[model samples]
Target: MRLGNVSLPVLASAVLCLGALISPAHAVPSQPWYLAAFDHVMRVLVNNEAPAVQMASGSAEQQNNVDPAYYSRVTKEAGTITLRGNVPSDGDLKVLQGVAAAIAPGASVVDRTRINPGVPNRDVWLAAMTFALRQMGKLNTGSASLRNAAITIEGVTNADDDFAVIQKKVREEAPKGLNLQVALKPHDVRPFVWLAQLQQGAVHLSGHVPSEQDKVIFGHAQVLFQNLTINSSMEVAKGEPKGWIEATKVSLEMLSLLYSGSVAISDKVVKIDGIYSSPAMVDLLKVYSKRLPEGFTLETSILEPVARAPAARAEDMSFAAHQARASYNP
Candidate 1:
């Protein structure tokens, strides 16, 4: 007998020689070579079996209980939408085709998908696919992919305005119960600046912010100033300096400390100018600056209340002390 060109007896001899070279006791542990060969085989099987049994409990997943791998990808190029990947049924395939057609009415659909049964969370998967295709249609040439429960959309558009609009939509209208990531290249603006000004029960926010960092600022605003009206005119742009989000959060915190003031961050410099009724507020500002992350410089122009008559001065000082206490607690 032979395995292709190598004869069986030659193969057996090579295996025996190899086993002899690797044996723990130098090839021949016992009187008979057959016994040594048997020992080597048993040792190999036992060593491999032990690790498999040990790892079975900790690392092995039950095959029958595992969720089906569902994948769907959509790409648009040269006025054509190409749909690819696996769907649960023919109905889902048609639905995805229809979705693509609706998203880009003038473009043709190229279906290259397979029917894959047992797609877990069918409705959610379909919704995510539709959302992905719509976002993809907005781009001149772009791609969106759905693997299991995560969707990623990355591409470019013709105009900066269109890119900004798509980014806002993705951030605001992503499907629930799925992790959606967007990486639309944004136009870079040099000297990235953000401003928050507080006056008369309202805070006006303007300037530039990264796509995801907007939510952070909004969350902080919602909690810090429940009564104040938030008027934000922030635009989406890339090129945020180091420690951008951290510095922004710190700026928001310091802004909350003022009776009326503005926090303007341009590039890596944070300028905080406002009025505080207490001298203690100045000390508080200094402390906040100390905790600011590296690569940031803080400049403050906080003002104290104007001088008045002796009685008014005393009362103002008392109110300032109370304000300082409230700031610490709040």
Candidate 2:
């Protein structure tokens, strides 16, 4: 029978379910059983196996059987962070581990790494690599190596300026005879060595830059246009004029702060108009202007954008015959 909204049969079922939930289940591991479980988990690891144990004989972590070996391959491809080789110490492991964690958040550490003592001068390249990887924005994908007495570094950054800055830092910090090769994959919209000329009130951008660089610069230029008309005649060619990327970024930063003006960049000189607001911009651009491509000279001109004052609107009042006279007496 039913009791309120419940029945005697339902009450008995609930009690039986509670009894099952209260039941205890114990798990005891035997020596061989635990070993087999570990073997199954590490079956495919490259350096983890019998007879070839990790070589952590006499290092800081020797008591704990931890190796201080140094040879790691950390690469992130297709949204997967793959880690391999061996680490010298827990510090190195932690550094690479941190990189892996950032690349693959909420992802498992597929640790196939072994431990052994590292070689001489491992710290030099290790520190350099970690610094470079952290400096690179967006995608973290690159290989690093330290052999002989030379350090060779090759990596790509999103923006031209960033790649340049990081490259300088890496070279400066690295020991003498360090070989560095850094490049910008796709230069971000930095107002580098390009030209934004406001002549005849028409915006004209012209300079030799990578094909897509035109789009990035114009995108920033258009923002300044507001209601003003834009005449984009920027050319997209194969390569940029010498020192164009740096000049362009400086220009973008210039346009962002200034209201309206012309920024002209050549291998020889960088000129600007309507820059009375910030004379410092001229000095800043001199760095790029010095590296003019082959034959170039300083030039400056500006056709201040002509403001089109809106025409006064007279109410029609639904008139029948509205005579139109010559509006302009030019």
Give the whole-model CA lDDT for all candidates, comma-separated.
0.75, 0.47
Model 2, span 1-330: residue lDDT tens: 444587745755665455456424422334333334444434424344533342332355444552233345544444455556655666776787687566457645455666554444455646654643443324434444434234344444333243334455655655454455444343434333445644233555654456556677777667765555566655433334465665565554454333345565544355544432245545554564464444456554322223333221112201100111111000
Per-model TM values vs. the true structure = 0.45, 0.34
Q: How high a TM-score does candidate 2 get? A: 0.34
lDDT of 1 by residue, 102-128 (tens): 888889899888777656667788889
Error of 1 at 73 (Å): 10
Clashes of 1: 0
